[model samples]
Target: MQLQTIVPIKPLGNPINYKAKIVNIGSCFAVNMAQRLQYYQFQNTINPLGILFHPEAISRLLEFVVNDKVFTQEDVFQHNEIWSCFDAHSDLNQLEQEDIIEQLNSKICRFKANVFDATHIILTFGTAWVYRNKQSNQIVANCHKVPQNQFEKELLAVETCLENLKKIEQNLRQINPNIQIIYTISPVRHIKDGFVENQRSKAHLIAALHEYLEKNKPLNYYFPSYELLMDELRDYRFFGKDLIHPNDLAVDYIWQKFVETCIHSNEIPTMKMVDEVQKGLVHRSFNPYSDAHQQFLDKLAQKIDVLLEQYPFMNFR
Candidate 1:
């Protein structure tokens, strides 16, 4: 008897290889994929503006980057003795207004440069629920622990999200025509938004993503990450303590699926070698100066040298 239901996913037409430059934005789950890419020494840039959870937040950043818009002093606010901008996550919050403004603008410049050469751009949307700042009548990426009364909570309409996403895609393509775009709904559950509301949020995101992908068929792909988690790994054991986030095992399983579908077949051997090297680097030896351990180190060093000689950009460490 079959044990578990599997989600069918087709391999990407243009798979990402070592030569491909990749940029990932949106959602903390993007970090999971970016971390794997970093581990295997793939050319990857992730979330320059930080972990933005909604499409509005992501589109806002992309719009600013494409237009070369700079955040002025008025765009920032002082809250809890920290200077920060609502357009970016709390991670970018700084102590000085000048520091935050410079950081945001610098990140936008870096994003422009990165996307210009990116071979693949991956966007992960976490939620459709958004918070609109009452003061400026604008949606904010993160509230940064501000009082709940200061913002109006809202669910983004499918039409609004679809338009924003299209704008983002158009802006990105203008800067880099050859770049392939991938979209996925984050599997992380927003339980705090209430279970039914969370489902509603995901429904909107899924609808918008499918509509976008259908219209822009070429060079656009959608990986059913949300389906994979909800259908394939339906057990609560796959989630962390809060039962909202994917655990390490679940993340690894998703990453394996991601590689299976998105990575070039030719890169498998090199990935294996890299995995071996990574494992060796982290392996612990009981004897620090034994001849056998020394020989092992020498062999590991040789393996690293061989890989690095061909792919000079890859760093074993």
Candidate 2:
């Protein structure tokens, strides 16, 4: 007797209209994806804190971008709350929690009220781990030198995470019921958790998330970000020196895959020079300092100078 093995296939939904505004949240990989979408001229916004509260620095970073100012390394670092150099002079931990909460509420309200009209929300879950504040009994974006042992412990169950996501969706759906949601898991490993534990944690998350996606209906979708990174580009060369995060090449590969799979077509708008550079990088022939490449760099510099002249608020110099 011959036996047939049946494979369950996910339904291929209708192609997403490229006209919608997209909001990306979650991890650094989500940030990379957002950047590519913005480069391609899609109406896109990236929430640096994901579902968490926004920091003051992130607001300033968005202000700079909206004004067409050139973003500097310092600006990026500040936006992400990395204070290695400046921490010596300032007690970043002393920033008022109430003020942060107010700012975050204001921004979230604005997005929900004005930006949710025709938006697709893409959420990435980095990990189940979270740090709670002892004083308020609330989860925080960062621990900020607060004694870890003082806080009550909680690891977000998959159900809790899914409920939070559904709440976010419901809030947006109030403004626009047609809103779509995409979920992805960050492939970047948390090496601080130790190799064996890290793998175990990721396995638990993936399994839980996959089960949730399978049970949920069409309003929510799961993108294979984890699979693409782990299965398609598993080579060590694709990762950075950290051996956790994807290097530039790997990032580009994932971005390209996203464009193909999610964006729907290659006809999306992109800067001509950026397109050229991307093609060069894909073929492994990009030389930033090359004479011909310098021409494009010069043009980009000229554009930046014009922007700097126009927006005196940006103090990149």
Tell me, by TM-score, which candidate is best: 1
The clash number for model 2 is 0
TM-score of each: 0.98, 0.65
Worst 10 residues of 1 by lDDT: 308-317
* Residues 144-176, model 2: lDDT tens digits: 444568566445665665555555555555556
- Taking all chains together, the TM-score of candidate 1 against the true structure is 0.98
> How displaced is residue 145 in candidate 1, in Å?
0.7
The deviation in Å at residue 38 for candidate 2 is 1.6
In model 2, which regions exceed 4 Å deviation? 1-18, 48-102, 266-317
Worst 10 residues of 2 by lDDT: 85-94
